[model samples]
Target chain A: MNNQIEIQLSAKRKEKPSFSDLKFGKTYTDHMFIMDYSREKGWYDPRIVPYQPITLDPAATIFHYGQTIFEGLKAYKNENEEVFLFRPEENFKRLNRSSVRLCIPEVDEDLALEALVKLVSIDRDWVPDVKGTSLYIRPFTISTEPNLDVTPSQKYRFMIIMSPVGAFYKEGMNPVKIAVESEYVRAVRGGTGNAKTAGNYAAAMLVQEKASAAGYSQVLWLDGKENKYIEEVGSMNVFFKINGEVVTPELSGSILEGITRKSVIELLKHWGVPVSERRISMEEVYEAHQNGQLEEAFGTGTAAVISPIGELFWNGEIISINDNKTGELSLKIYNTLTGIQIGKEDDPFGWRVKVE
Target chain B: MNNQIEIQLSAKRKEKPSFSDLKFGKTYTDHMFIMDYSREKGWYDPRIVPYQPITLDPAATIFHYGQTIFEGLKAYKNENEEVFLFRPEENFKRLNRSSVRLCIPEVDEDLALEALVKLVSIDRDWVPDVKGTSLYIRPFTISTEPNLDVTPSQKYRFMIIMSPVGAFYKEGMNPVKIAVESEYVRAVRGGTGNAKTAGNYAAAMLVQEKASAAGYSQVLWLDGKENKYIEEVGSMNVFFKINGEVVTPELSGSILEGITRKSVIELLKHWGVPVSERRISMEEVYEAHQNGQLEEAFGTGTAAVISPIGELFWNGEIISINDNKTGELSLKIYNTLTGIQIGKEDDPFGWRVKVE
Candidate 1:
């Protein structure tokens, strides 16, 4: 664990059962890690304080300009009740990348990881061991500069908040039906689409609701330019299976490079699966489906280990895949990743970093 | 003005301001008008209370997803010390347009206008009489469903806050240089380009800062498809003076249909100036400049009445308009528009709505 987060416990810490009846983001631990950064102060005043409300000026940049970036990783309890973070360093690195794009201050990668590990360790009991559950850690930094001008904040607040999450999928790994949102585009090139900033999600909300109202669980966003190339499936990165070849969209300037997407690629490669990252257009996918060449599709993200996409309705044209069920490859990947995370199997990639 | 707003002031009011030293958004007037909406209670609790901190659940949809929309207008004190709102009806109409796009509930237009007028009346001294100054009115609504789901919020909050704003443009509107961002695309077809939502502004912030850092005042965005067809100029709509004919890019799905753009078109048409809206590409504009057929270029918006384009730098190419000054036609349009706003000229188009 990063030793940087020195705790100052809240006088209001719950006495008992705080560890048992926990739901994601509903209950918080006693303390939250905070750090301040400014051009004058550099990075100073790192403290773990009582979880409380932060009184921000009404003109704070975060309120007006949305200059915020966040990272989500989890601390898991293993079979032996030992706690470990799955690739904590990766979250920090990705957060910094998001920071650079949003013009927010980047963090010292090592210190961020340490803070997350320490905070999770302090609330280790909050990490549920009842299979496929963990303690969700939110490392977010907001532009705290109180100004009306739309510039990057000179001063900022970096915070880490922990929440106890139950099963991420709730119903386990189940196949989902998504809509091809040809009428709406999520992001465009040279935009904040690649960054984990708040605006990208905001831009997608309107169409996402439309898709959901049309009776779909998620949305498959195509490239904004031609509305053809597959970009993202709602919040997750997508993969398609065609004739036993696993194909996913290459990370372009407009697509987020998801950590789960990366892990899946590496694991598939290690297992000698024919995986390729290329630009797969909508027409090709539709034509393949029509010809019965399409096997399956799924999405990958932190909240969802793997969500199978069973069907797609593209611009009023519907296409159903084989069985409308979770594919074999996705099921295997989900199990293997979950196994490594819960200490049920040896992590050959050394992905888990154990917290003391 | 919309007359649908119901006001219930709190038992407090800030003392009158001297009105001279007021900075934009620094001092909020007393008695802010607010309303809430949900599926059950379509809209309720329309009240005007003392300006105070709003108590929001930490998981408010606006905090997590940027499902917020806002409008910027101003109340001007005419010579008789009477407050007047310039085309507030347009803002109310536009606000609903933005709300629909962001999947937020719409407010009654009459109610919105009435509430604004009453609030401005309560804080009349905040309306600055100084040239190029007025009491800035920010009417905004945010979704507060307080959930992590990416669906449209079941509940929404609509509020109006007023602050005295000096001249919006720091430099008196002589002209400004803008960088042509071929690399970054602002909005694509079926995107949130036409809406005055928070996400669009957040998406534009980094690019704007980059252009400023690169020594330009603003950015000129291109279509996301080919990066060729000129869209809006950052936040405002663009117009060109070519061979004595006023020209603007046609409102493709990506271009924001600016109110000022329509006003300018109507004003130009009234004065017998030939105007045409068509697809104008960057290559064509540059070619016109090279052939000396491009006379001038300027931008139009609520805040920036008219900003002349002095220089455009696009991918190592710098194109300069003649004389690096505001064009003649631009000055006429600015003067005509402001004259109508400040009640200095004839109200030919019935644009100004008196605050009752």
Candidate 2:
């Protein structure tokens, strides 16, 4: 282990929260991975330090300019207490992609992987044993240079923090009602929408609050230009089953390339399910519903894996899918992916990386 | 003064930079204004303290979610050493507007103005005596809650920091070459573009860098919907003088309502210049140039009251305004605005508020 990452153990451990009573991302593990980058020194001083408040100048660029990017993944535990990570490499690759778009220095993927593994291993005990609970890992980079110039910051800090998350479906997998967002535009081509940056999320919050207030679980965003084409559903990639053919929106440089979405597409392809990626329009979906061919719809992301869309409220009409119930295919995909993640099923695609 | 803003002066002062050698926003004065907000207490703890670094949990939303906004203004002094803030009330008004857009708590405008006056009065000596130098004031807010729930932070900090800035044009105000940016979108309707938020600035940095690398001083942004109508010139509101008629893009919910821009329009109207705010497209500007009707173009902002655009590069064509030199009207507007700002001109509109 010549990783050169200094480890400073906490002097006293914090009392762990009850795993069964955990919220989404409110609680954190004791230690976090820290790294610094600068123009003078590319990236140096990799260390694992006790999680505490970080000090920065009042004028740090992160507080003023939003030159920040982050990635989310999960560490799961089996009945034997064996820790596993699902497609962690994809997250680092996406992080670098986000870095190039934000003009921050691209991090070394290998070192980042090593740091994440070590950090998760040290905090392995924090992984909850509940059926659906996992340790949520957040790796983020922020511009820290203390200046008000509009250019990219010359200094940055990267850190990895872990939090214990409860089951997304505490009661059961209930399909959600979605609103077709016509007023707000989330992202457009040639924008930071493809990047996992903070600005994109910031731009979506107000709309999300409005949708939530209107008694919807999430928003299904349309393309920014014409507002006719389907782009994404909330923060997740969306898919629809029409006339026995599964279709998802193509990667058009505006919507995020979700790892879970990719896996779902692959799984459907492997199972001989007719699947295709192309431009989807809400009008076409409505037409299909009018023709009585609309079958199922769902969203995919790292947090919930498969969030079935039961109903869509668009243009003063409510379009129900599959009688507003969790589609059978959505449940199968969720179970298969979670099983592969938690070591309960055979890993045919080699998606899981086990911790030694 | 029952403002309830406790003042704590610094024990010792650092050496001030030479006013003649000051840069933009790098150096700060000895003191700053800070106020905190919480769901339970609302906004409290307003105080003026010694300038110092701030501490926050690493998971603070400002680092990851981009929930932040800011306003920029200047404090100028005449030869008599009497400090003046040009339309300081407007900055506070815009700050609250930005706050409402970002879902942050709106600050009390009267209290904010009072705080700014007191802070500037205390650091009045730091206001540069150089003819082209003045104290740059930046009032900003950051969401400081340490959570990752993809919602608005429950905690916030609003602060005001002052820095002495050198003249934007150390030499005479030379016109700048601008590149018409058609590749990226700065903002769109139903977005945070109208708000003075950090995310909008972050979204524009990469394009600005590209334009700068291409030897242009700024990028002229087009509308996100059609990618045709002119939206902004870099961070400033743009104006064009065509065939003796001054035209600018109206505030169509997707462009910032700049204070300098508003003042420029009022000044032009006061001078009885034919001015209008309407949608002006790049094709229209090019046609006007082709017909030899294009007379002058310039950008307006707090930093440079008037930044003349001498040349524009778009679609393999070069459009020159006023033969690549500053226009006479542009010069006159610059002189008038700067004159009123430095207290050398009469305040007809009562825009200048004295810091007494």
Chain A accuracy as TM-score for every candidate: 0.95, 0.98
CA-lDDT, candidates in order: 0.80, 0.92
User: How well does each candidate reproduce the native contacts, as fnat?
Assistant: 0.48, 0.71
| Residue B333 miss distance in model 1 (angstroms) | 0.9
Give the distance in Å from residue A187's predicted Cα in candidate 2 to where it truly belongs: 1.3
Candidate 2 chain A weakest lDDT stretch, 10 residues: A1-10
lDDT of 1 by residue, A1-356 (tens): 23355678767665433444445566656667889888887777777786666665445566666777788788889778988888888899999998888888788888887777777777676677777778777788877775555567798888887767777666666788899887788888877788887778878887888777888988999988888899999999999999899999998878888888999999999999999999999898998898888998999988877888888988778788777888888889999988888788789999988888
lDDT of 2: 0.92
Q: What's the TM-score, to 2 decimals, of chain B in model 1?
A: 0.94
lDDT per residue for candidate 2 within B231-316, as digits (tens), equals 99999999999999999999988899999999999999999999999999999999999999999999999998899999999999
After superposing candidate 2 on the true structure, give the runs of residues whose Cα lies further than 4 Å from its correct spot.
A1-3, B1-3
Q: Output candidate 2 Cα RMSD.
A: 1.4
- The ten-residue window of minimal lDDT in model 1 chain B covers B1-10
In terms of TM-score, the best-performing candidate is 2
Across A1-356, the per-residue lDDT of candidate 2 in tens digits comes to: 33599999999988999988998889899999999999998988999999889999988888888899999999999789999999999999999998988888988899999999999988889989888999999999999998887888999999999999999999998899999998888888767889988888888888999999999999999988889999999889999999999999999988999999999999999899999999999999999888989999999999999999999999999999999899888888999999999999888999999987
Clashing pairs in 1: A2-A114, B2-B110, B2-B114, B3-B110, B4-B110, B4-B111, B5-B111, B8-B48
lDDT leader = 2
